[model samples]
Target: MTELPGTYESYWMETGTGPAYPALEGETEVDVAVVGAGVAGICAAWELARAGRRVALVEADRVAAGVTGYTTAKLSAQHGPLYAKLRGSLGAEGARRYARSQQEAVDHVGRVAAELGIDCELERVPAHVYAESADAVDRLREEAEAAREAGLAASFVRETGLPFPVAGAVRVEDQAQFHPRKYLLGLVADLVARGGAVYERTRIVSLHEGEPCRLTAEDGAVVVARDVVVATHYPVFDRALLFSRLEPHRELVVAAVLPAARDPRGMYLTPERNTRSVRTAPYGGDERLLVVTGEKFRPGEGGPGGVGERYERLAAWTLEHFPDARITHRWAAQDNASTDGVPFVGRFHPGSRHVYVATGFGGWGMSNGVMAGRLLGDLITGGESPWASLYDPRRLHAHEVPSLLKAQGAVLKHFAGDRLRPSHADDVAEIAPGTGALVRVGGRRCAVYRDEDGGTHAVSARCTHLGCLVRFNDAERAWECPCHGSRFAVDGSVLQGPAVHPLEPRTLPDEGPSGKEGSV
Candidate 1:
């Protein structure tokens, strides 16, 4: 096995730990209830609180410690060559709305950070989408023009700050990058100081929409609010069939320490090689943490060597680009992509009056998350937002049908096909130490992992979300549902979700000579 560098963690998570909040114990009432304490949730709660609305920000875990904690933390409006594609799919005006919304989000982060005196290391830098091949240069030029037309300070440039030469690039000026947790924690504090409530370790299991929305947490505590915002990375409550329209993707990130002089000094992205995103953050004097992200794949599909190979590829790419980089941290991030490129940020469903949802950021969550906060606040406060029409969940374009079908087709493949496939091991003894596999115990399929001590732990193979068989991700050491991106630990605890319930535990039969004695 090839040795991979860096500790298996996120750089942002290691540097900052946000404040802890008490879980909801009994019935509580608020004007608004925001689910999930990620960037979108915190920002939404902050927005409502600032508007003088009594708000409760509830989270299953620590604030900003889920997808937000694992992000690359690039606060930029220049989302690759998105403008050009939007121009074609949506008209010129539609593209302009997206550009304006994202740019406003970018500015909003900086403004909020400065106003709150949060030392999030926020700094202005130009964002670039560069192309290394001649064929992609023309596309970059087109993108540059479309971006400028859509109201961004964009230009096509041949020279970039990268170590390698690029054929051409679309450069957008005045974008920024910062530490997400620091900024969000600052917002969390302000939300509390402003008479808003935040509850950590409060998992909302059910939502009842009415004149006043009722949310029930895992502990049976209830939160009654006039409005509810579902900001969980994947909508835990999929009333509008969002699971069919949203496709889940997971990406690997590798960060390394490099001399400040070697820092790129700007955020960069490229469409080549699956997808590559590059940014840097202040580590200490004369050194910067270079974070590189790429290798996108579905949750349960690990391609050849599982997620470990994806991490290896990302690390190799980082070393190839920045030889002086000494890898320090590595982790993975997940996001949902809508059938249409635009995110669904307005009403949760057509019938929903007070319930709103924000999902399908499509890997550009920082700006989109902030945009969701502002948009959701405006919708709840009855303030007019011009971009609301573009992100409305009910609006469906004819162009989205093909993509939607393709996404659902893949889901169907995973939902039914995985169960028919051969099990990983015929007997528990065939499983190697420190590895997991699907085995049949008492004529029932079970996901069993063998510890180095020869003890066996088993859970049902069926995913709680949609009956999809869970696959073991060797690199992350977790079982992942491919259909909708739910994750579980070896102990059958929910890690990430559209699935609120943990996998069902199963007991193994008595072991023979080949099987182990101890079982869980």
Candidate 2:
């Protein structure tokens, strides 16, 4: 078996890290508090600050450390067949509105980058949605027509920059790609210059909703904002709005240094079930980082050997296609999807007027995130934006009721199955080094991980967010919640969240030191 690459590092991470910001000192009030400093929050803060409003942007970790850092960075509005789906669900006018919003987002990014003087390697390239099969070719043709009808500069094409011949594709011209982190940090700098505060490592654990929303951090700090934007990918610790509606999906991404000759000039994706997207990032050498991403799967239900196997599959596929490629980085990124296939980017709900949310981008964060920032900023500072009604969070389509119910069913299945089914391991002695499993410890299910150094760690198998069971993600070596996509480290620390709380540790019943087994 060919060995997979090293630890979960992204090509973007190899670049300069985000500038350090001090944690929030104490109680601070702002006009708008933007939580989660990924692309969405950064964009939101940028737009609000640009509007001369006082903003405080807080992050649990560093900026762009979440999905934004790991993205393939395709800044295209041509999300695979999205316009066609939007037309089907939201009618012709709604689809056109959606396209207009995304196009403006691309323009907004360009305007912001140029205004801020950010040299983030921004490039203007075409994006292609191609397919190898005849059935998908038909879908592409229909998709191209839908895109054109919905205000995109799209046309049907026979050939893309792919290594192999594509049967059909919908090519959208003048889309783009860029280094997300650099662009985001540039925004952060501008935010500070405009009297907006940026803080890191300050995790908001509880939100108290009132006339002025008060957020209590894990430390004793408090932030009071007239309005708040819940840009935390999936809205955390929620039962009313996002949790029940959003479906979390984990996707495998691999970045390999391919010869400059084989590098494709256009951002390309397929219409396959387990969709594959191919693009390249300039790394300043003969071997540019060619990122070929796909092999998406729902969490908890096993992959080849967890996500590690998914990376291997990506590697195998890369070797088969781009034989000259040398695999360098392998990582997985999680994305949320909405029942209606349109992102929820407005007020969190009708009841919560002061709170807004931007989630379920369906792996198109660059465009959607920028749109969220622009629309949310407009709604917050100015009156309601024209685009607000199209993406209103409270508006639920009748056709989407079935999708909502279907997603709820999956969550209920995982929540109930983990409680009913027996643990994967009965005895702690069964655990081996560098692996993890759910073990029946003292008649209670606990996740156990044996480190390569022979250290034993255990935590509650149930997720801290919504009580859904967390399965081990071997590729990232973390516990991933199948329901909401929260991830935890081996030591039970929160890695990514909708779950802000870490998994509580559980003591083994009768296990002794030095790998000794005792009776329960």
Candidate 3:
């Protein structure tokens, strides 16, 4: 398998590595304290600082080291398969509002990049969402119409620069793309220059809320602020039922050295369920990197081999299609998928107006992240933001029930099946070679696999997240959580999250020190 692209080498090397920003040292007061120093937090700090508001941004790790560092970084108003879904779920008015909000975000990014003179390779290019199957054409038409109604410059295209057979595609013109890390760093530098402080290595343990919100950091430092923005991908409040409202999906990405003949100009995406997207980044003069992403699945469930298979699949797909391209980088990023298929970007909980949260960006984090920051900044500064109502977190739309029920049903099936299934190891002698089976081990269920060469491996069937029983998803070849969509490899490695840690490898009686059990 190819080396994953998400490691420090693949990310920090491309963009110059950043130092760990200092943690919150002691009690400090600020106009706004932003949690999670990702694009959202950094952007929020930048906007707040520009407005002459004192801001403090805190990150558990280094800035942009979380999902933001792993993002594919496409800045486009054209979200995949979203317009039609939004129309159905949010109605015509809601759908239009959603589109407008996204467009406003794109424009905001452009304006910021221009004003800051940030050399993040900001370019206005069209984005295409193509349909792989013939049936998807109908959906594309519906999406194009919805986007137009939503006051977007969208149209349908029959042919694209992509080297695949597409039924039809929706194109959102003048959407933008950039180096997310560069853009973020530039904004962060500006914010710091303006007296806005960014504290890294500061893990927020808990939030003390009331008239004023105080965030207690792991180092025992407390931050007193008038308002707080929880942009930690998933809010850390009350273990967040918001996580249940949205499933976590893991997606693979391949950043390949582009061939001389191919210059990927516009952003491209497939409308298929687990489809791929292609875009290009100009490394320098006469040098470019092509990024391909897709192979999405819920965490801990894509079969026996964790996320390693996705890299292999993407490598093969890239080589077969773009043979001249050299596969230099590969990685995976986890995204929060909302049950209603829309992001929640507003006040946290009902009346907790002082605390705001931005979760469930789906796969469009680039656009939505910036949007959330601007919207939240406006909320804090008492400025008028047109996009606020569409992304309201408190509203519960009725249309999301069907999709939510489908995911919940899968979770229920896994929970039920895990209880009834027998361990595959107990009847190992009768099992066929080159296959895996569910088995009982010490009264608990486990996954036991026999290799083609007759080697055996065993792992626990319980998912790391919430302890929901995992089921083998044959299509993806991983153990999938029917509950929140965590996937693990047959060897018990993580394929996705909200399971941040990988599965614990089982110890074998015959193994030595190297073969001992392993955990996160």
Candidate 4:
């Protein structure tokens, strides 16, 4: 199935199916009411339920259908040159805390996966962070030292089995990967079997904070609970202005069938515009499929080639390097890039109790999601967790101010620029093919695209949700907002949101080159 809004048709979904959990219908009360039934929320529900606490897990959609379903699913303490940057900005103590917390999380997932007998194909693999440039080698060395100082098992490796060459790399041993959707669906089933309840298709519209927080769904159902965990990838509440604290980045992934000799033993990555990650998943008794993902860009930004192009490049790269490779499945995932370079997994706001938000996983959602669940669970259960200080959302770091400022500036620029002009609605011919242009129609600026086939599409320049001007993301072939990361298709269909409304379509005025026929 092609990629669709709110639906994740991943390779993991091919595994055995599970029972469905319906949405919240009427008033429900629980000891802990978790919002968003992705990994973080489900993990929280699992943990709390195991502790004999009444838990109600609520999801806006099906289980594991959000960011969790689309991840590369690597569980590791290595967070892609994160520790070295953290050491410089947040000091050695901060970096060490971050490493220890995530390491604990990796262990936690392994333990849970094993304990539940989940057939998610969990296994240990060494994660590599490599560099191709001389300067990048130096940075990689610094990061290796930082990782060691943080008590992580990391070292510089001069050799790897990768088909490509690299100057140097850092190996974080004991990392693991699994079928993400399989493990998540298993957890959901286990939670239900253990007498925990979850509500799918129940969107929480508002929350009333008090002794017992009251969560109201769009369908008028309410869940009053002693604790609330907001793990909706990007927090739904704008009260903390999380939109300003982080930026969104979109990454692409593709799976291909590989011969036995072509399979990789572990995960590998390089810090480049086009990164390559390699892992393998079992298809049957003797067949395995390779998973490859890369192509990173700031939200709505990428190379001249977009998601499809990147997928093709990865497939080609695999074939050139591993001769027996064959393409099969492909997809894209988007994650919030925290300004501080670490995930925020604590209180939702200053002086707020009984409310917690988890976000900013930075493409390492597998372990970070567990970290969030465990930490938030501990906090809600009135227990002390050593991981809290490292991920505290209230903690301020001055270094992140620059990234935040730049992101805020860009968003403001787009929002202001969106109101300046109207878009042209006439025809595809007005735009030169292969280029994105802005034009005015009805005194409103909109995005106009002319495809290579000479067909044209015109969409509302103003993003549906916040009125920010939507920019043409040449890479993904979609309309995106610099403000809140909403994505739409070229034909004015909603792809992702913050914006629920599709770009309004307009009819073009008929005109011709010779002034005798309709054009555009």
Candidate 5:
């Protein structure tokens, strides 16, 4: 079945047949409540259930349908020159703790995949961060040293199997990759079999923080639990003003059909160039597919050549390197980065006893997500985890202040700039079919999309989250806020959000286009 043309459709979601889960209908209670059904929530549910605790896993959509489903799924600790940067701020031991936690998560996933008899294409491959430029080679050398100090099996390898040449690379041994959705779905099944409950189409509208936090759903169902884990990719709460501290970046992913003989034998990423991440997934029984993802930008911003241009760039890159490769499927993913360059994984803040959150995994959600599971699971079970304080949401770093201030300034600029001048076009027919544009009607800005059937969808251009005007993200055919990472469908439905409310609907002008015939 073909998905909507411009909407975000992940290859993993289409290919994997995940298990069916029920929706919460009435009042429910559990020892621990998980607020999202991605890997982090899956891990928390699985861990708590395995430890003889009642877990009610609630998802706004189907299981593994969130960010974890769309990930490139590299289970490597070498997240693009991260340790060297962390060592400066988190100190040697703190950085080592971070690396150790990620390594443990990788090891756990591999072990669990085998334990559950899951055939998720799990492969143990050495991961490499390669550099093509001389200066980049120097940086790679320093990163190698940092990786070793942080307890990774790392070395600087001058020779790599990349189809293209590289000056040098940091090779970390025994890192793994797998079909993330399949692996997590296997865990989800195991959780259900072990007497855990999972609910889909259960959107948490609000959470009352107290003894046994109460989560009120959009449909008016309530779940009261001793502990609540908020593992939604971007934290749902804006109380901390995280919109300024955490920045969102969107990247294009393209997977090309390739012959089975073309195995790169490792997961590879380049930090110097346009930041390409490369790996392969098993296609049929005998064939393999190569995946490359890069070209980062803000959510609402599309390339000049159009929304489809980003896919073309990746296709061009693939044919250049591997001439026999054929373009197949492609999509986009939104990743959030903490200003301080680490994740916020423990309690929502130091003062909170029952509420916890896992967010800002940056682009490396796989390992960090699993680590968040283990960390949060331990905290809920009252176990002393060594990495707890390092990931505390309330932990303040002096370095992140400037970044937060700069991000807020950008938000203010976009908010003010969007309202400076309203576009004069009012007719719905002015918008071409299969495209969307922002225009003013009745002196109010509204986002308008014209479908191939000549139907128009119009909604308030102002984002519901913080009043920042959203822009038309042509690539995804959705409304994306540049300020705080909230997103909505063209029809005003909330997609991703710190915003619980949808965009306000607006009626368009009746007159189509103003075209007229001239009488001579």
Candidate 6:
């Protein structure tokens, strides 16, 4: 096995410990309840509180500690090769709305950071989507034109700050990047100061939508509000059948330290090599942190060596491109892609009156998340937003049918086909230490992980969100459901959701020579 560099953690998370809020202790009432304290939830809560609405922000974990913490933090509207595709699917006006919303999101982040005096390392930089092959240059040019038509200052150029040459690129100015955690934590502090409530480690188990929506926490605490925003990344409460419309993808991020002189000076992305995105952040006095992200795949779909191989590939690519880089931090981030090109950012379902959701940001959540905050706030406050119709969760275009069908097809295969597939190990003895595998114990399927200390933990193989079997992700050391992107720790605790419940605990038939008996 090839050794990969960097500590297995997010660079953002390692930097500082943001302020922590207490979990929901007992029942509470507010005007609105915002679930999941990522960028979307925090921004929404702050927006509502600033508008004199009583709001409560509830998070399953810490604020900005989920996908937001793991992101590359590029607050750019230059989503790779998207304007042209949007023009085709949504026509000219709809594409303009998207561009306008995204650009506003970029400016909103910088404006908020400055207004509130939040030192989040916000830096104004140009963003680029470059094409390496001649065949893709025309598409890049088309995207540049489409973006310009959509009211952006976009231009096609043959030059970039990248070390390697590119055939052509679509460059957009005045975009920015910042430390997501720092920015979010600042908003959270302001939200709290404004008399809005913030709760951490408060997992909402169920939501009862009504005259006053009631959200029940795992510990029996409740939050009553007139409106609810399900921003739990993948929407834990899937009353709208959003799982069918959203496809989950996981991407690997590798960061390394390089001399400040070697910084790329801007964010760059390419569609080639699965997908390559590059940006830099201030590290120390004379060094910058180069963050590279790529290798997008379904949650549990990495072939051969599994996610470990994916990380290796990204690391190798990084080293090849920047020889002076010294690996420092490595992690992964997951996002949901909507069937339609646009995100679903409005009502949770057609029947629900007060229940709303913000999800399916694809990989551009930094900007889309802020966009969701502003839009969701407008909807709850009964104010009109120009981009509301474009992001409506209930809107379904005819062009989305094919993508929806394909996404659902993959889910169906994993739900049924994985059941018939063979387990990773026939018996506990065959499993290795510090690894997990599916094993048949007493004729029942089980997810078993053997700790490095030679103790084994066992849980049912079935995912709580759906009946699909869970597969071990060796690289991340978790059980991931390929169907809907639910992740669980070795002890069966729900790590990422759509699944509010933990995996069912199971008992192993017997202990193997190298493993001691343990229970989840």
Kindly provide the TM-score of model 5 when superposed on the true structure, using C-alpha atoms.
0.95
Tens digits of per-residue lDDT, candidate 5, 212-231, equal 89999999999999899988
Output the better candidate (3/6) by lDDT: 6
Model 2, stretches more than 4 Å misplaced?
237-239, 510-520
Over the stretch 1-520, how does candidate 1's per-residue lDDT look in tens digits? 3667889998889888766799998999999999999999999999999999999999998899999999998888898889998999998999999999999999998888889999999989999999899999888999999999999999999998899999999999999999999999999999999999999998899999998889999879999999999999999997988989999999999999999999888999998998899999998999999999999999989886888888898999999999999999999999999999889998999899999999999999999999999999999999999999999999899999999999999998988887788898998888888789999787888999888777888999898888899989888889999999999998788999998988998888767766665444
Tens digit of per-residue lDDT, candidate 3, span 1-520: 3344333234423674655577789898998999888777787778888899999999876788777888888998888867877777678888887888888889988888888888887878899989778887888898888888877899988888776668999988989888888888888888988999999877786888777889997668999998998888866564445765777777878887875458757899984646788888876666578888888876645645645666667667877777778777766677887888888887888878698889889889988999888888888899998778777887776777787787677667666765765553475444344456666655666666555555666777677767777665432346666667665776787544445455666543433332323121
- Deviation in Å, model 6, residue 182 alpha carbon: 0.6
What are the lDDT figures for the candidates, one per model? 0.92, 0.84, 0.75, 0.77, 0.82, 0.92
Task: Kindly report which residue pairs in candidate 5 clash with one another.
Answer: none
lDDT of 6 by residue, 256-353 (tens): 99999999899999989899999999998999999999999998887788899889999999999999999999999999999986899999999989
Clashing residue pairs found in predicted model 1: none
All candidates: TM-score: 0.98, 0.96, 0.83, 0.87, 0.95, 0.99
Ranking by TM-score: 6, 1, 2, 5, 4, 3
Worst 10 residues of 2 by lDDT: 511-520
- How many clashing pairs per prediction, in order? 0, 0, 30, 14, 0, 0
Q: Which residue segments of model 5 deviate by more than 4 Å?
A: 1-8, 424-427, 513-520
Q: Which ten residues in a row have the lowest lDDT in candidate 4?
A: 511-520
